[model samples]
Target: MDSGDVDFAHTDEAARKRRDKAVGLARYVWDRGIGGPELLALPDDRLRKLARAAGANPPSTRETWSVVAEMLDEKSRWAAVHPDDPRAVPAHADEKIMWVKPPLPPWPSR
Candidate 1:
């Protein structure tokens, strides 16, 4: 195959990977009870931070994700519109949540 064709294949693979990651981040946030309205209100930077916080497992350096992924997620278009009163609500709700994790095996775990 020509060099151009090889480059296209690699580009396509990278695009697919990015798309999958964006979808995963969205689902993770939604499962955390953060939906469309709240999502739309957040700036891309804050949203990416939120996504990383909500990640099942996230990488360290690439915390903010890519512009391409943000665009695909429709977050790039969401400009950070500061609320008239930023302090209107508590950052965290008062409710308590119980999270469950699998029990550690008798054998050493990763």
Candidate 2:
């Protein structure tokens, strides 16, 4: 779908950056087969830091990461049905209607 096909408010730069980072982290861990209980057990601060490093707006509290997780799972399902439409994923958590491919940055190795 063309960018114009979706009608939604644009996300500000900072928020978009944050969302991108979060998505990247989620994608990275998922791609590495690192998730489920192990992921859920991560400390909120660690998750927040990872999200921040990934470019996502960090979750304000421990409970907030679940929102991103849910979004990721939903996007995965959506992609399964519409495999060709990767852009169907939302660009920001606050604006689910507006869609964009979540940026996937290279993981930072220590």
Candidate 3:
């Protein structure tokens, strides 16, 4: 991905920091034998406690779930980009597409 493609000026530092923290929390859970499925299976109260235990401020049930969902989304994007890696599991191929050049500037009309 080209850095130039992004509008860094408009980027939200706060949101990025939050997401980064969430990713770290999600990773911590996974490393501790609690991946997405296990996390989702835990009761709501337990999930809130889990978030607090991870040092994340008292997040609501919805916020805790969002962390899992966001982490899963990031994971899927990673798998899509690294299909050949042994650790990458295949997600639904329907929504995943490998890179393709933009259709614009239509390959020099010959």
Candidate 4:
């Protein structure tokens, strides 16, 4: 079926089966430490092969890399500051600064 023509509806039994499958896949991945960057960096075809070997469908390599990059960025940011440093802590003191855009004057009429 075409992407737009695919049906999203599922019966109760089908939903339960899907949920069970997902849980099983999650357990398998967790046990194998599948979230690590080495696995995340594998090519899409290779990832698919790995996932099939693990009995789960693999997502696109781009999606996997995006997730890996986000996790690494977060970890790096956290590691940059000392735990006891007050200045290292993120503050909400200027949350409004991002939304405060400068006003522009009206354009002259032709």
Candidate 5:
């Protein structure tokens, strides 16, 4: 293959990796019940901050839902273009974002 072809392949793989990460993160936020009309009302700056805090690129559009949709759509497009590629959602994705509370200390022994 030509050097150009090799460069293109590397670029495509990087894009795929980025899309996969965004999709996982979007799902994590969705699982946490973090979206709705209230979030939509947030100013663009705040929305961008929230996205950044969630480890996502700041949305190009003002709507947070659009950010989630954009992330998901990119993954879907990749899957469509590479039908043989394994497209499984990462197992236990929520575990990455879960904030498990520490259990109370065992009751004092009598």
Candidate 6:
């Protein structure tokens, strides 16, 4: 096979690996109920190490970071409803912003 074909195959394999890892991580988080704040609080190096230990095959550094961010978001939303949960609300003020605009009715008021 040509070098281009070889590279494509390798890329495909990597993508599949990443997808598998993400799914696994998602399942673990779902089953364990480990809050996202805990994950976000981890240092980048530490997070990467945890991912490796968790058997994640992140396709790229960017993707790895994104996964961490997603975990945090999920944890935050869950915690918001679970008062006893320890996960703090997301720190980003913008993320917490809720518009006060009135909701439109299904039909115009007569």
Scored by lDDT, the top model is 3
Name the 10 consecutive residues with the lowest summed lDDT in model 3.
Answer: 93-102
Q: Candidate 5 — which residues are off by over 4 angstroms?
A: 1-25, 67-110
Candidate 3 runs further than 4 Å off: 1-14, 70-110
Q: Give the TM-score ranking, best first.
A: 3, 2, 6, 1, 5, 4
All candidates: TM-score = 0.38, 0.39, 0.44, 0.32, 0.35, 0.39
Expressed as tens digits, the lDDT of each residue in 40-60 for candidate 2 is 666676666566655666656
Best-performing candidate as measured by TM-score:
3
By TM-score, the better pick of 3 and 6 is 3
Candidate 4 vs candidate 6: the lDDT winner is 6
| Model 6: per-residue Cα lDDT over 25-109, one tens digit each | 6544433344455445545665565566557743355564456457656655776788675444333324211211234679866
Candidate 4 or 5, higher TM-score? 5
Model 5 residue 41 distance off true place after TM-score fit, in angstroms: 2.3
lDDT tens readout by residue for model 1, 8-102: 42476766765666677654553443435444555656655665566634423242244324542453233233234433222332211212122
Against the reference, the lDDT scores of all candidates come to: 0.46, 0.54, 0.57, 0.47, 0.54, 0.52
* TM-score, model 4 to reference: 0.32
Error of 3 at 39 (Å): 1.1
Model 2 deviation from native, Cα RMSD in Å: 15.5
Q: What is the lDDT of residue 8 in candidate 3?
A: 49
lDDT of 6: 0.52
